[model samples]
Target: MPNKHPYTTLISAANLLPNAQLENWVIIDCRHDLSAPEAGRAAYDAGHIPGARFAHLDHDLSGTKQAAAGGFKGRHPLPEQDALIATLRHLGINDDTQVVAYDAHGGMYAARLWWLLRSIGHASIAVLDGGLAAWEALGQTLSTEAPTSAEGNICAKPTLVASVDADDVLKNLTNPQRTLVDARAPDRFRGENETIDPVGGHIPGAKNRFFKDNLQADGRFKPGHQLHEEFSNIISASQTAVMQCGSGVTACHNLLALEIAGLHGAALYPGSWSEWCADAGRPVATGA
Candidate 1:
């Protein structure tokens, strides 16, 4: 079970104190903004949850430039397997460590870490429920000081569980074994909104389930039983499905939702529509 999926948890401010049981747990702060790339690092420098390491979107997780071919594309792309392996090792992650990733608002970008670790075939990872927001709401103490990097190194175990490229998506356009789920807002999915990506609407047969819908007014995700009901209407209990969104960032939101819903086996389309439009040959659909 090196890459087996783990349940997401919310650690109380009081309980976050390090102990032998929690020592193997790796916590990462994944705050980011597309408009202001430095914001996350600056925020980390200012103050963050104790015992957290910063995972910058542009620097730590994704590639800086697009690949000539078979590499990353618009927004964010799947990083090289070997390079990602090295990243986990430096983070002091190992197959047994319980990895918890979190962002300021919710598990948005943090979910990407959840997806990536699982994609590489490591399932011992999860997103922090409610993210840093919930933790701070509990009046937790934060730190401006960075935690010391552990002396031990992690052994890389690449499992390559779930993914779908533009070509694979194209081939699956009519395939029943898979279903495309867009994590964008309803208006955006319907082409009523197009502020983010250049294109509007969604893939021809895709379904829309705004990741926000899964969250309660308090910002935490709904209970798993409720999630199962919501997803069962759009996705079969048996299928793991595929998730996407603007530039592939928020799509991880959906993947996170499914995990909460007890729906695993889903794949992430990291490049998503931004990467899709990068190739003119790919078809674009508009309107609701």
Candidate 2:
């Protein structure tokens, strides 16, 4: 039976338990360390939610990096449509598959998968709120054994999510059509940290809204109304929002928070600051 209440944005571990074993459901472990790329797979190999398949951020989720005439595409570009479709099929994700993506990092990585699915027009996907900790807190068992399934026949559809490129963002800098929201930490946004990306500061007009703020102390997302109020303060009712971050990964966390807050039509800047700062011609801003 199809899940009567299919999860679109976020799913609790308790709600997921009942349908976990269902054939139409696919659980993905998206645990990833930006610094140590191999750590996510190692952690998955050590133990994960039973029957969960691993999706590496670099291998499965991101696309090949390109060297353009001006600058390189950000670290993690969106995967090719066909390549992404192949990955979904390999993961046994059908059109109706209820994908529940989880990670140890407060759904930071899982939200990437969630947004990717939505970008390909798959609406039945969700991030596991509170992630693996939530499941273990409920006394769920982990498994080292990997599970396989028949290849799926899911196809691509129109993207349900919106996105913008570096050009669009540059235009926005002068024309000011949209409000840019930076999802990186305040220190990073303020040009105080340069360990990850070569650039230290953020786009000139971008506002800092660290993705962690969307989560509570327990690592779960705050209530929709609360998220709405917080985000509204950053973005005005008349202004369209554009979300960005280092290499464009965590921006999805903000996008997911926007969805939870019922604020729709926000666009993702996939290249983000990593790409923006790649070309020195582009302007940069520092400080709060």
Candidate 3:
């Protein structure tokens, strides 16, 4: 069911191989380590999928943080809409283009691109299931040769996906209609892991989904039926859910997984834990 559309939320490496050489298709390599900012571009330079362009998490995907605001928007905020549209146009993506994004660390980073495109009303995007590892595991070849694409005339339309701000989250805490789903790991959700953000713990009412649970042992997303069953157990089919992570990156992974599970209408909390923790007055929850 997930593969029913060419522009579905998830696509397999095998399905991507044949059309990879096509002109209208754009493949992006979204590999990055939060600790080592330059590593993703370095890895892309070493070798990448043929014709794939590199999109760094910090440079291309995120916006600037104001020190004056004390990082109120979080470490990796969403790029300004105009700037992001320019970047996409520079990448030679059009309204009809088929975009495939991938990363070595599962679909964590790639899902962000998928969600961003979808949010901006561009529906022709998919995360490379299993990511870079899957491409290599299938005995496919990699290329260091980069292709130059003509500038595309893509424009950002109205946003289709829903997003929640800090205020909305605070209100949801008391509103029985919404559920907050945290994509961070169990330890981080419990205030035990404090590596990324200075403050630990999660939004008071959020439940931990760990992002990785969306994948199988091989790192590919679980089958749609299984995904639907898993998410349904945590969040009711009737309740609206908001997805979030440490700094809003991995939250997209859970969002993508939810779409694959056929559970649509879940919104993104882009500020996430980083933004939530920035203000001391906001409530925080510790332990499972």
Quote each prediction's TM-score: 0.88, 0.97, 0.95
**175 Cα displacement, candidate 2 (Å):** 0.7
RMSD, one per candidate, in order: 3.0, 1.4, 2.6
lDDT by candidate, in order shown: 0.74, 0.92, 0.87
Which candidate do you rate higher for TM-score, 1 or 2? 2
Among all windows of ten consecutive residues in candidate 2, which has the lowest summed lDDT?
63-72
Clashing pairs in 3: none
Q: TM-score order of candidates, best first?
A: 2, 3, 1
| For model 3, the run of ten residues with the poorest summed lDDT | 1-10
* Per-residue lDDT of model 2, residues 1-288, tens digit only: 455778999999999898899899999999999999999999999999998999999999998878435447899988888999999999999988999999999999999999999998889999999999999999999999999899988888899988999999999888998999999999999999679888799899889999999999999999999999999999995138999999889999999999999998999999888889988999999998
Please give, for residues 1-288, the per-residue lDDT of candidate 3 as tens digits: 122356668888999999898888899999999999999999999999989988989988988875445657888888888888888988888877889999999899999999888878888899999998899988998999877999977788777688888899988778756888999999999999689998999899788899999999999999989989999988885238889998889999988888888888888889899999999999998999
TM-score, cand. 2 vs. native = 0.97
Query: Which is the better candidate, 2 or 3, if ranked by TM-score?
Result: 2
Candidate 1 lDDT by residue in tens digits, 1-288: 232444443333334434212667778889988888999989988888777888888877886557866654767777777777778777878767778788876677887887778766666676767777777777676889887766435555566457777778888876656788888889888887677777777877788888888778877778878988898888874255888887777888777777667787778777787787666677778766
Name the candidate, 2 or 3, with the larger lDDT value. 2
Report how far off residue 148 is in candidate 3 (Å).
1.2
Query: What is the RMSD of candidate 1?
Result: 3.0
